[model samples]
Target: VMRANYRKILVPITEEAKKLKIFKGEPLDLNEVSNLNTIVEIRKLIKNNQAKIEYLVENKAKKKQAAIYLLTKTKVEYQEILKGLRKTAKKQQALLDNIVKKYHEYPKFGSKIVSELDVSSSVLRTAVKKGWLVKKEQEIYRDPLKDFESRKQKNQIKLNSEQTHALNSIGKSIQKKEAKTFLLEGITGSGKTEVYLHAISIALEQKRNALMLVPEISLTPQMVKQVKERFGDNVAVLHSGLSEGEKYDEWRRIRRGEAQVVVGARSAIFAPLKNIGLIVIDEEHESSYKQNDTPRYHARDVALLRSKFHKCPVVLGSATPSLASRARAQKGRYELLLLTKRANQKSLPKVDLIDLKTVEFTGAQFDLSIPLVDAIKEKIAKKEQVILLLNRRGFASFMLCRNCGFVLKCPNCDISLTLHKDTQQMQCHYCGHKEPIPRKCPKCQSEKIRFLGTGTQKVQEELEKLLPEAKILRMDVDTTRRKGSYKKILDGFGDHKADILLGTQMIAKGLDFPNVTLVGVINADTALSLPDFNSAEKTFDLLTQVSGRAGRAEKTGRVMIQTYNP
Candidate 1:
């Protein structure tokens, strides 16, 4: 499997590279800096007739010529560090308790009680202690407050019948401490969160930990809130949006066992949860689960691997599973559990296509075609809300020179640069290359450079112009960059504060607006227009998902998807 190969390769590299201790290679020449006490142990552990190392590592170590050297600071036992901290935490907690009691008894005498527990000389010593923990500006504790939390947590929740069955089936097939992949094909409005919580409850019952992976930045908050509401402070959340120090703290929490359930975006899969029992990947089919950067790990795949390592289970929940995952389910590799009908048992949305080819417009170059505009007007007049989706974010897809038909393109990318009308600049969505839009086209000397194609900004602006009385809102990346933007927009949407929400793919997936009678896709062509093997799949999935968002409420919604080739 892809995971097995990575574990056999990356683990050795991670361990070896971090220690700078070369295995099956020559020792680092520490002769020049002669304070070296290098002890090279090259005893080849080969059992039976097989000539290989014991670690199941793919790179076989040479027997006679292997030069394995140990560095002075190579390995540190986790138990030793914990033992020391446990002692310190005991002392500190005792001191804090005594001080707290004294303050309660004599509120004014708190200063006097504090002086009694002071380590007067500690203020002078350890000014030069050079250690990883010290370098991180962390206090060396007997038992840190965070650590105490994990150790002292006692509340264990009981599972329901459905949850118990899920656990037992998954528990058996999952093989703990190894990779067990299970797809929980639950409905959007189903209690999949509760199922995940119950599985995690089982993990905690076994004294193992759990990691929940979310596929998007926007999804993290809601998931985190749900997990926190259930597990209290036993959760640590991580995402690309967090700062380095925030990530460091969350990592430490996992390592220290202070965090039992880690809710994060993708990378939470690699969380060093000592003995992981369950891994829950929400929105498993999401492309966000795949890492575009090097070490190209898929969080969902990694979670499956980690589950195998612990011989546990992995739950991949999505309304619409990817074809590959569905195929696996069909092959019996994954136990297919379906929560097909909506919890409320309402009908799914009625999807219709508005062929843009039949519509003719005179001065209209933006996203909304005549039929779509008519549909939006019809929905608004009926007192029902609408949602318009345009995948690309900026104000315009690209700037074009009317004189020579020259399209503005990014210097670093293989794509056209987007025109950010708000910023008066052209920005490369790929490399983030940005420059002010020239008054005259560089190549053609044409001042009449036109912003072409459609985007979220252009759609929102045109909608506002067309429907003057309608309260239209936009929720793409640019508008939601600030903290709490997703929540704020979601709240606004829930309250029906906006008549319509015009956005990119962010508004897709599992958002339900009961009053939203109409869901419109300005360009169905954008999704299918991709030049990839998964084009048809992407088109179908996106089209289906966006349609799913409409009729989630009792109103029995309608969706109008406009396509150029319709």
Candidate 2:
């Protein structure tokens, strides 16, 4: 049986029976049921709905067990019991004395008390029998962020004139409970996040909740940290990176109104938050906000709908707003708010373009130019960090037989299979088809093969050879496959354990490293040749956003773009 219901049962029929022209609802002998490829449902199989159904219940966030002790004996009676047991039962006497001294702190977790007093359950039962104490069970909440230490903001950040103006506009909408949308067009390091936080504070002051949506899972850690530092335990995080237990506990907390702020990825739009006063979508132009699968929906559209229901303000913030959003702002459909300067009063990074056609290659591969390599070396000598962007992830974009003019491609997909040197396999990124690296061409027994395109892995190898003394950390889909791997890599980089960080577009935006003083784009023209009509727009947005990553802190920064087209 494939499935069953209270009144019916579903069974799969073999293909042979269908070939034999067996019609639906046609009664078949039990012997004939073994050979068919069809679906059959038997009705009225369970009389009075007496069929037994079983399911597993996932209650990871159930009520916890606690212990509370109260002294039933009076002070004088306790003293008499202790005095009488001092000589006969020294252990009981000591236990009784300790319980008496800490009776006021009765309501504590059972585990806490056990670890603190170093006593067993049998001893506690004996004490209860002697009337020295009373024990009872209580329920407590399971804290998902128990290990996360709340680092409250030591000194409040003073907002600039533009930030104050933007906050004031959002504040007015929140105060009047108006369902309005705002397009916050701010350059990188323009303090848009500060405005969002201040608006959230105002919402909380009005006794309302706030919901924040970030485009990528990579951005969630930093955003959650900032929000947690501001609101402490009042914030709950929801994202696919979290475990099932953590998600369940956080969901329950939000439902119980224990958390006032919700921060997560795209799916966070459906978070069970009530009385929302504001919704903020950071990097609003990112395509990651659109669900590609069935039940397709965009978080931005959903946020607008939710604003209508809650009568709240929705803020769409981005350094480079999408053309659609910009058009809307131009049409006066969305209230436009602009921030013209960096929050730290620093100048933007200086960017230089290098023509790959004329520039000298730094290594055997033509991925990194000499100028970019020299800049990286300079930064390393000064104890500063660098960021390199490569839009691809494998060791090589494709494997080709130079002699036969043939390329290895996935059978399932027509696209070329990328060569991964670490895995010694050619893998198709689209369909996940993998095969061993080839020595001789299958079509012609020629061994003249070459890897033609640059990716993050190949660049990493080249960087290591070029700068053997420098520490490098690579971030890509291949390296960050395990849970919590994102946090580990980011934390390592933030702690200055690596001299250079390299990755694909995932590292292009929403990353802040104060020590990074140089940024390089291996191939700035990768996205310009795409088949989509919006390819140019996407390429421009990416370059602008990534260039902003440098020179964010007090130190000046430099950027280098290498392209053959230019």
Candidate 3:
């Protein structure tokens, strides 16, 4: 009779929403909401018929569990079996004794002793066959917390008024289980990350995990260090840069509920985490969040769905947010949090633009203007570090012949070949095709060939020639292609081992160098002239972010932008 009545009733949900599998193969429970239209339509249909309706609300909570090995019986209970085995198994007594010793160490789980047994000796197989040993899978607690041996407890920071207000609002949502989205728009060095860490602490206090998405793998080392310093082994890092084995292990950690905090790039949004209390998208405006392939998913949108499902808060933080996010924030869709003041109370850096059309060239190289070179020299004389930004890599952009106006080009690509000075080869950045650096133009066969255009490699060479005593660490795709090279270069620069840090746009953001008082932009118009509308916006962001790296300490920083467009 109950089954017949259940078939007469109807409930429906959206296809995508139903994919969550919250309601399946049963009458809709009162705890779950059904569509109002469906309920109203069903009532009208049943009005003329003899039918009764009953509603019941029952709260059901289930504990999540994972498979773990446990002993079939206690070590004390196994003594009788060992006594029987000692008589029947004469040669297997040694292996049996070792297994007995291992059980004494970890009596709750027998799989812990599986590795200690040499199954090739046939003792463990014999014992299992004789009912002396049993392998049983049971529910076990998964503990993700691990002790970091050398980490020093960081001193607690006093939040400024602005940070305090943002924290209070964000924490309120968590405490009330209200799913909300916040756009944390702050200027460079305005303590956005500090707000994120503190909010994550609150989520942990609520006994929930947090998921943080960063844009690049290069940014992971610094972020992992910070989170580990705070939460230790409760954190798991995911990114393409990790080995397959490492990725699997980290995924298992999250799936088994061993990791309460997940920090990763785009793919991390889908981490197998349950009851996530918070989701953070650092640098939310970055284009990296948009997946270009099939099953296309944006990290921000995924965060929203996850937040809605778990009744948590999502924080989108960036100094320069994307237009779509900023527009949403302008509306009532997302709550906006602003951090206008610098955390350290330091003044913003001074910016100076040198018009390359009018400025004097330095040492016959058009790449470095005289004023910019003077500023670098001045900073080095004061023993302060410097960072030079040139978005291009390789030694020279192209090789050109003076006589016939012939240019070297890649065989497989329409783009010109780039000269790598260190490798003495012309490489195609697009297709990885490489050839010997030609002494003369291939088309004209003229010896009067010149390497034209500027790259980070060329800039580094010019700096070496001009500033002979300056220790320059060049970081780009070429220098940092090897694993751990990025961290090594940054660490060397942070330790004051290098006087100048030169790199491409990868060095533009997420780097804080206090001793760097001078930031020189060799070519500000590189991205500005691209055939894209957002070229101007990207150029502005790169300039602003790179300039923020300097003068972060007690020093006053200066920026000299050498540009043809002024």
Clashes of each: 20, 7, 0
Candidate topping TM-score: 2
**Candidate 2 clash pair list:** 13-36, 13-37, 13-38, 14-36, 14-37, 15-36, 15-37
Question: Candidate 1 has what TM-score?
Answer: 0.69
Compose the digit string of candidate 2's lDDT tens values, residues 1-566.
11222222222254433334443544333333454343232222223242222333334444556786666866677677777775766557666677568656654555665667677766678877876667888756555445456675455999999999999999999999999999999999899999999999999999999999998887777778788889988999888887665776787788999999999999889999999999999999998999999879999999999999999999999999999999999999999999999999999899999999998997799899899999999999999999999888999998788888999999998999999999999999998999999989878979898888979999999999999999999999999888777877888999999999999888888899999899999999999997989988888888898899898999998999989887
Alpha carbon lDDT of each predicted model: 0.67, 0.84, 0.80
Q: TM-score of each candidate?
A: 0.69, 0.85, 0.74
Query: Per-residue CA lDDT of candidate 3, range 107-220, in tens?
Result: 334444445553342555565676655545564433222222326758688899999999998999988888999999888888888899999999999999999998877677
How far is 411's C-alpha from truth in model 1 (Å)?
2.1
Q: Candidate 2 — what's its lDDT?
A: 0.84
Error (Å) of candidate 2 at residue 559 is: 1.0
Using TM-score as the measure, what is the rank order of every candidate, best first? 2, 3, 1
Ordered from best to worst lDDT, the candidate numbers read 2, 3, 1
